[model samples]
Structures are given as C-alpha cells and as structure tokens.
Target chain A: MPEAFLILILFQLVGSALQTVLHLPVPGPVIGMFLLAAALLWKRSRTRTDKPASSFDSPALSSLSRSLIACLGLLFVPAGVGLVTQMPVLLANGLPIAVALFGSTLLGLMVTAFVMHKATRDRPSPERIPDTGGQVL
Target chain B: MQSLSHTLHQIYARFLPEPNMETLFWLSVTLAVFALGVRLQIRLGRAPWANPVLFAIAFVALGLLITETPYGTYFQSVKIINFLLGPATVALAIPLADSIRLVTRSLPAMTLALLAGSITSVVSGVLLVLLLGGSHDVALSMAPKAVTTPIAIAITTQIGGIPALTAAFAILGGIIAAMIGETTLRRLGITDWRAHGLAAGIAGSGIAAAQVAQRDPVGAAFAALGIGLNGLVTAIIVPLILYFLPG
Candidate 1:
C-alpha cells in the first residue's frame, strides 16, 4: 500500500512539474491521472502474453486505488468547509449563484442523457444488454 | 465534581497549547465527524439528500463556529487530508482505464455526450450567472462548477476565478444532481443506465456517481468514465472558450 501511494505521489509530482514547465492548462493531478492510465495500458500491453489482461492485476495498487476513489467524496470536505469563509461572496450573489448552479446542473444532465440515449438507442452496446437481462420482471 | 472538571480543563488547555497536539486534535475531530456522517448516510440507506460530505461539512462548520476556530487554522491543521486529494485523484486512473476497456464499443456515443454535456454545463453556468448580473469572478467560477473539486479549483484559479468559491459551487452542483438527477432523467424518459450514470458523473461528479453506484455496477463504471472524461474535456475547453471570448 505504501509503495502504491509512493507511485501515485511520484506521478503527481512529475505531473505538477510538467505542468509548471510546460504551462499546461490542466491540473497536475489530472495530468497524473492520464499519465498513470497510459502507464497501466503500456504495462498491460507489454506483459499481455505472460500475464492476465487485467490492467489492475496488481493487488496492492488496485485495492489502494479502489479505496481512494471510493472515498473521493470525503476528500472534498475540507475544501467545501472553506466555503464558510466565502459566506460574504455567497450571500452577495446568492440568487444568481443558486439559480446558475441548479439550472446548469439540470440542463447539463438532461443534455448528456438525451444525447447519449438517442445516439445509442439504435445499437445497444453489448455491455448494456446484460444490464437489462436481470431486470426482466 | 468541580475539582475534577477543573483538572480536566487544565489538562486540555495544557495539551492543546502544543502545536502537534492541536493538529492531532483537529485532525481526529475532522475524521470522526466525517465517519459519523458516513454512518448516518448508511443508516439512511445512502439517500440522495443524505449526502455524507454535506453532513460532515455542516458538522465541522458548526464545530468551528462553536469553538471560534479561524478557517485558516482549521484548514492548516487538516492540510494532510487535503494533500491526499492529489494522489487520490491520480488513483482515478485505475477505474478509468478499466472502464475505457469495458466500454470501447460505446466510446463514440459516450464521447459525444460528454462533449455536449460539458460545453452546456460551462456555457449555461457562465451565461446564467452573467444574465443574472453576477460579477466576472463569479461567472468565471461558475464555468467549472460541473468538474470535480480538485480540477475545478485548478481551472478556476487558471481562468482568474475564485478557487474557494468554485470548490463550493462544484460540491453544491454535485449534491443537487444527486438529489434530483435520477428523477429528472426518468421523467425525461431516459432509462438507460449508461446515460443515467454518465449524466450523474458529468454534472454531479463523485457525489452523484456514488449515488448511481448503489444499484448499478455497470452504470457506476460508466460514471467513473464520465468523471474522468468530463474533467479532461472541461479542463481543455473552458480555457479555449474564455480565450476566444470578446474582451
């Protein structure tokens, strides 16, 4: 677990360095995510014949990643609490902020779902087909 | 009873004056409150409105208020957890890679949906804020409200938005999505789990994705994909759009 954490932190550090050096618009951790994904894909392809094809074949790394991602919600609590200090800004633009957040979220949800549903309606993907199999009640 | 109370208070006062002990106290309090929230959320069966983060924040905020702890002091004490967010975000690559491999066939449709949803989220949020006479900072912060918190913070800072405000708005947007996202999709006659999960991920991010994961593993996988892809897409396009905007 410690080794896995070290790897993640190293990737993040490298990503942050790259962002600073290259002036990338994206965040360092996000770039780290892409880099880690690319690394996993590369590692899988290289070891394909000798091992199983699962990208998450390493137990330590896989479990650690799963736990971290699972608690992604908890990770935001500290920052969200910072909102307490921004109470004045929030109060000043209360109506617009409220409307904009709720309205845009709903609109974004509908547009994504509608477009995805319509685009894939004619040809249901194989993975989604099984989801309906157990729901035939 | 009076002497015992005085003795306990003396111990606390002496121990808390040590910087390390104070840090430890606040850190433990943060985790304990969040754990209580998780328990309450489970007790409530993970209902949309029973969001653990929301509960935990409210509790912690109340604690701070009662104790009169400055936000900066509390933030400094809990900086370790905040630091972990970076590595945790990098850990998202595991599920993201797995989901990409699983949903290759639906990649095209998923990509299109992500693009449409992300663009709409940014444009609608900024436009609505401006239409309602919000300041430039508020509007810029609103641009990345749909992205995940860490990325949203970075994007907001990049585009001259207030990172703290963006973080707050992003989480609020996520909670709102978790509360009404499924019902809204169903009302619109969209029943496909993929679409449901994708929307939850794009707009609601982790909170909504966690909600979708309760009954649908496949949908959850897509939600993970949605989170990562939308993060990338919004990160790219927000700057591009702002750059091309008329000054």
Candidate 2:
C-alpha cells in the first residue's frame, strides 16, 4: 500500500527537516527512526485484545523489515562510487592514512571488546534470550 | 563536439536543456554509474580494496573525461544521489535498534570511547593541517573524519570543514580500517569477534561493517550497531565539545 511507502518517506522527510531546521547534531533520519519506532511501538501497544500478538510479529512484516535491512547493502553503491572519485587523493594519503585508520580501528576495538567481553562474560549468554537469536546477519 | 572551441559552446548549449535528449542523456549516465558499480562487484573477485564504490568512482571520472563533460555539469545530476544519502544514513537506525540494550548498558564506556576516537582524529587532523599549513576548514573537517560520513558531515558543516571533503576523508578512514584493522587487532591479540566488529564499525562505519560481516557476521552486526550509535553519539558530542574547544 501507498501508506507503507509513505510511512517510510515521511520518516525520512521529518528526519531531513529536523537536520535543516533544528540543527540537531544527530542525523535527522536517526531522529525520524526513533519517531517511527515510537509510532510502531505505539501501534503495537494499542492492540491489547485477545487477538494474539501474532499480527504484531507477522512473518510478512518481518520479511519487509528484512528487505529494508538488505537494502543497507544497496545504499553503499553510491558512496562506493563516490569513493572511486577520491582515488588519487587516496593513493597519495594511502600509507599514512592507512596507518591511522587501521591503528585507530584496532585500538577502538580493543577497548570496546575488552570492556564488553568482561561485562557480558558473567551474564547469561545472549543466546539464552528468546529473540536474541544467533546474532547472524 | 568534434571541434575544440565548438565543444565549449556545445557544453554551454547543453546546459540550457533545449530538448528531451539532454535530460535523458544525463539520466543514462546516472543509471550507468549505479549499474557499473553492481556489475563490477559481481564480475570481479569482490576484493575489499577493489570495492564497487571505488570502481564506480573511477568509471565515472573516466566517463566524464571521455565525454568531455565538465565535473560541474556531471555533478548537477549526481547531486541527486548525494542528496538521498541523508535518508539512507537515517535508515541505519534499523540496525541500531538491535543493539539498543547493549548500548544503554555500556553508554559510559561507549561515550568515553567515542569521545576518545573523536578527539584522536580531530587533534590529529588539525595538527596535520597546522603542520602542513593547510586551511583551517580542512583542519576543522578532519576532526570528525574517524566518525561515519553523515555525522562527520554535520560536524564539519558546523565547524566549517567542507562536507564533501569530509565525506572523502571518512571513506578513506573506513577503507584503511577495512584493509588492515584486522591485522592490528590480531597482533594486539584481541580475539573476540564482537569486539573486533565493534571496533570496525566505530572506525570504518559501513564499509568496515561489510568487511567484518564477511569474516564474522556477529562481529559485523555489532560493528553495524557501533557505527549507528557512534554516528549518533559523535554527531551530538563532537559539536558540543568543539563548541567549547579552542578552534
């Protein structure tokens, strides 16, 4: 239905608007995302009848969300093209920047992983959570 | 178009958009740009360094040169794709939701990490510029280079680094992260997949996310989560901190 597409676009519009209007340092789509989540959860919250929660967690809905998730890969195409534009610059800065990038990323990972691994180690593994599932992409 | 001086007039004339052909022609280039990207990914071995984004960009620049289209003219339409990038970035929230609990629990450490990451890049960027005698805006833009593009762009915009330039630098950071971040992590003996992925996301954004996913989905997913959260976190924190910091 047009409503679904509109919902998606509407979220984006609101997100963009917030970026331009409020100057939220946070990305507008992110704002729009929370807004959309609120709406979805709100709609989800209202249906408290004997009607099972099945509709809320419908396979159809999950499939749609899954595709949107998949489109995350598609979104890279444009940026990737943009990447090619900077090849000359990249080549020039390649060695030093590579050092910085890899070094920083490694350092960031060590710190995050160290803290997280320790924190989650004692807790029941995420696998125990019903919907936590297998953490596969 | 064959005549040298006439080519200039022809380009200017095309700018006027006299007929439907010109519009269609530009549309074709845009589509080709997207197609070339997909095609290269499928056709090649799909090596990380030989990424689709890199290929499309090279093709587009070469195409522009061959067609003799001015970079400005080509950008007129490509800008549409650029504009859509904002919403695509916002779409990252989908993945972010999956990690909300983890983020909430670890907010302090995560914030500390993000702040550290931002400071590392900003100080280095500005220092590099000052040391090299680059423009102040370049220094300002480079500050957020470690963060993903959208947040990086906003921070750059606020501090007056050219957004496009910042976008380029952010991608460079991601590529470098993708290329060898793993090696460093291995050398450091950080063996947890989740931590590695988180690091990849923090430093590399989506590119690193995809790279990490290729090796380990759990780590990749976490990386994606980190990318979104850090993008948001840095977007907010960097601007506020930069506001008080001596520029």
Candidate 2 on B54-133: residue-level lDDT in tens? 55556666666556666666665555565655555544554555456556665665566555554555555555554555
Off by over 4 Å in 1: A49-57, A121-137, B1-15
Ten-residue stretch with the least lDDT total in model 2 chain B: B129-138
Clash tally for model 2: 2
Reference-based lDDT, each prediction:
0.84, 0.60
Clashing pairs in 1: none
- Listed in order, the DockQ scores are 0.50, 0.27
Model 2 RMSD, rounded to 1 decimal? 5.4
What 10-residue stretch in candidate 1 chain A is worst by lDDT? A128-137
lDDT of 1 by residue, A1-137 (tens): 77788889888998899999999999999999999998887877678566665534476888888778767767888888988988888899988999999999999999999999988845433443333211101
* Per-residue lDDT of model 1, residues B103-163, tens digit only: 6878788989999999999999998988898878899999999988888988898889987
| lDDT tens digits by residue: candidate 2, A1-137 | 34444555678789879778976766666677666655555665676657765443344444445555444433333344444445565565544445544454445555655555544543422321122221224
Displacement of residue B4 (Cα, Å) in model 1 is 20
